[model samples]
Target: MAARRPVDDTTPHGTTPHGTGYGALLRTPHAWTFLLPALVARLPYAMLSLGIVLLVHDTTGSYGLAGAVAAAAAVSQALVGPQTGRLADRHGQAAVLVPTVVVHACAVAALIVLAHSGAPDWTLFLAAAPAGAAVPQVGAMVRARWVHRLAERPALLNTAFAFESVTDEFTFVIGPMLATGTATLVNPSAGLAAEAALTLLGGLAFAARRDTAPAPTGPAAPGVRRASALASPGVRLLAVAFLGLGTVFGTLQVSITAFAEDAGSGGLSGLVYGLFATGSMVAGVLYGLVPWRSSARRRMVVCYALLVLGCSTLWAMPNLAALTVAGLFCGLAIAPTLITGFTLVETLVAAGAKTEAFTWLTGSIGLGLALGSTAAGQLIDRSGAPLGFTVALAGSGLGLVALVTMRRLLLAPAPAHRTVARGGAVREEAAPAARRG
Candidate 1:
């Protein structure tokens, strides 16, 4: 078992411990050990979709097929991810992750082989399906651990979540460049094989850290029914908002690639696209370090509004250079919006339902990715890259609209109390009672 550090009662609410900064969380026992592996485990989340697109398109010479296959994989993940997270909540991360990793790795390996062998289109989709269904929800699991470990220190918990968001942005920045470079420079099979290897190694390493894993929620008491996190109007609104964000991301990826190809710099698409994440990552790190006085919902609204404005700039960028600049500005809003959304999820759901809630949130993003990719691909194919930008702009506009209309639903009553169970003892903590207007 990991060593338990008692919370410093002297620290006031909404503040970190008196002498420690956000950096102190990393110095806490086993923090780096767990975080490094989890980071590795999540790389494939960024890699696989783009990797599949590159691999299938290079082999089949059809962007349509490539997009459809990628969309299928994303849809499968969205369908299966929540169930896997629920199992992890009822059982444990190691138990759920070990088998799922094996299946996912095998599926990815099969995909590489099938793509290389000039297999039929149907066979490619067959290989892609299991990979997505079995992809471990490592990000959600890691956040759950943070929540479990820092339940008593709300301020530190917020910092930890910010750190996780920054890592996510970092993964996208690196993962795409790595995938595209490997596939373009070496061979498509090699890129996917690398992804498979990383998934296995990282999943195993993360699962080995049993000392820090949260205890399973186990079975509910007999005759006692529990409501799902989705039952909350706030959670539903947040999911829809996330769906919009996902559409922006998905469309931006496909559209940017198409735009780069049209500009005669296809090879630079990954690097050019990475600039977007670079901006988000820098912003996320800075966002995490500061204390914010605004409500999470308000922050989300402002960020979404900014996102729509940023994406609108894309429609006018006549070349890759201008688009890259627009991408940097567009990325500025992503991490802040996502951080606020996840923080709201934490506040809206019961502790027992956290892992599942996070998964559902992720699943919603996957659904949006599927929808966005499919629509953007067709639009780009028929009407060119400009129309693809329109899709992203429209999606962002919808998200901003949802936030404004549903702001009242999100202001519904927060739970009055929260319970944390540790070492066979149950402790009740008072939930913050304030609601933002």
Candidate 2:
């Protein structure tokens, strides 16, 4: 008979390859209890985002201004992210989430009222700022909870993230469609208003769950408090990677719409995004189902190469179907890279700082997209979609360069003992023998 696998904290339950990891998260009762509410909370915000852009653009007849408003929200989210993450880390998710949800609800209502009242453009932007700021870091918080609830099995953790990523993709694709339908059938603002209500309900429902508490992964330490999760070399490199990739994605979103519109198929923008989402969704699931056999370093290198290739193809091709195919293939890298990066982050930080660390990761991606979108939009105004895609492809290539440069810091050999302080700073002290090995 085969030797029985060791049973310990890390593997409290036996590892059933076919039945384990991401598959278990969805199948388990406890996991779904938390997952359901998170999904609902995200759905409305997703809808609200698309609805606002379409509604504002329709009302103002200026896509540029509408784009500006959307970008402003991204800025607000980035600005408040660290603090919000810290709050969730120190106090708890409920402590941070409850109030954020309440404020977000009120802020959205205010934005709608202001927009309808012929509020000045600047005033409308101001109102939207609060809405953006008030939104909770639900996605990050949810992921953190998984770390606590499923601490023993890193594979399961990977699956949870995979599940979250796919859910987000689905929401973006379906939510926008819902908003578009509502806008056509009723009024554009109607969809946004519906989003506002749904956001409050969904965010609050998730917050109310007892299981959604923040997890403390490592020891707490003083230095961890001031250290931006971005300060960690691993995290910094990952952030740079995200920046490049997000720029490509952000520019592509804007440029694709322009491409379709110029071709007299304006509605194709939604279809294009849908294709991208489908690719990501399909890839996320596959990434989770496949076993992780290679070392982290090798895996990341391969994944990044795939991403670079996918992006490069987009730059070279102008055909809509071809672009979509390339995008789908390129999207395959996103979830795996993110999962690996976040796992590395988990190993690097103290327990107290996990929230901030992950928040910074998410924030970096947000910031990159905002900057990329702004720059790409400007470029499109001057040059056009082909040039925009070229710039995006180049940006992604640069990310690969950044990753290659940091190989030593990231691919360092594991230490024997890893200790985390209260503030979430980590120190690795290798045993003399382990170092010798």
Candidate 3:
């Protein structure tokens, strides 16, 4: 049966509707047209950090320089992403994506050229900035489209958010393998080159599928009180929490590598990382399946507390096997925390600002990862791998503090406004962000 788009905005934040599965979300018309390309575009994001590190390291032969270049790009992306999302809201996604994709491809080419030419280190920063900035926010845009499609069906939206998080973790698990494998089997530059190619092709394909894109929301009307997505207190809180979440990711990658190397099992780093992602993937699938009674506001705090608890043991693990087990435990809390955060987003901001709001969280993660990696590297250089794990634990602990103290912010009402469909048609109703499950 085809999924119906009724007015279910009154439904609470948790997944309460029993029969709506991810299949139901996909069974509708034109779903695959936009979805597959979005997934394709997003894969490069997971690849870029590693790919850039590999290529730059090959050229510079200095891990410090290579990591610095990658960090510059990630920070550049984090700063520019929400701006792109806001522009997409004012104009159409396709209008913004065409130029963004073109710039991204050119920038990547320039970065590769600079690295191979042994240009001054400053030159790499120049190319890396725009390459990261112009990388399209396909993941956030796709989520906005999902909001436009299922604004009335909150249960299905819950499943959709869960599915997207799982897809993200899937890419994270696969992207590093593809990048490192290509560099090993082919050439160092090949990994980043493949990443650029995917962005160019998949971004264009996604942009061309304009029929499914969220309609351009030109400006907020007089009745709409919010001036920006970040104006919402809840949105800001989630962004902060997600920034902490990113540190876990950034810290783990470097720390795990150090751990494995210390134990004479350096080859197992990828396997350990994959094990962590697998735990999140399994948890995400199960999270979407269960119908819950708690509101999303309460859920965020609980899930984050669990994440913090899981991270507390990372600094104390005695060996590679123990560290991997600790990572797996920490991973189990990740997807659920992310799923709840995005769900809260759907209810926290008005339709006009959906994409921008989502980008804020996504970009925060990027920022956290860059900062966390730098911090962990410094700590490990001064001390050891065990000290490096403290970065993840400390970051998450700070977020938990906010989650517990300022959770009332999560209950702020979702600003009221209907989503404008293509050709200026209104397609949704006002929704309250602070509702019970």
Candidate 1 per-residue lDDT over residues 199-241, each given as its tens digit: 8999999999988988987766676665666777878998888
Candidate 1: deviation at residue 131, Å?
1.2
* Better model by lDDT: candidate 1 vs candidate 3: 3
The residue-by-residue lDDT of candidate 2 on 245-348, one tens digit each, is 66665666666665666677655666676677777778777876765645555566677777777777675666777766776777677666766666556655
Ranking by TM-score: 1, 3, 2
C-alpha lDDT score of every prediction, in listed order: 0.80, 0.67, 0.81
* Model 2 misplaced regions, further than 4 Å: 1-19, 27-29, 44-49, 215-228, 315-322, 412-437
Clashes of each: 0, 10, 0
Kindly report which residue pairs in candidate 3 clash with one another: none
| The candidate that achieves the highest lDDT relative to the unseen native structure | 3
Query: Model 1 off-target regions past 4 Å?
Result: 1-20, 412-437
Question: What tens-digit string does per-residue lDDT give for candidate 3 at 1-437?
Answer: 12324222323444466656888988857989998998888888877877776787678765456666777777888899999999898788999998998999899989999999989999998998898899899989988888888866767888888889998888777777777678777887888899999999999999999998888977556565446788778899999999999888878776776677679875566678777887888899899887766677788888999999998999999999998898888899999999989988777776778899899999988888777777876687669889988999999999899889988777744345555566867577554443211
Tell me the TM-score of each prediction against the true structure: 0.89, 0.82, 0.87
Model 3 segments more than 4 A misplaced: 1-16, 219-226, 261-267, 414-437
Which RMSD does model 3 reach against the true structure? 6.9
Cα shift from native, residue 301, model 1 (Å):
0.4
Tell me the TM-score of model 2: 0.82
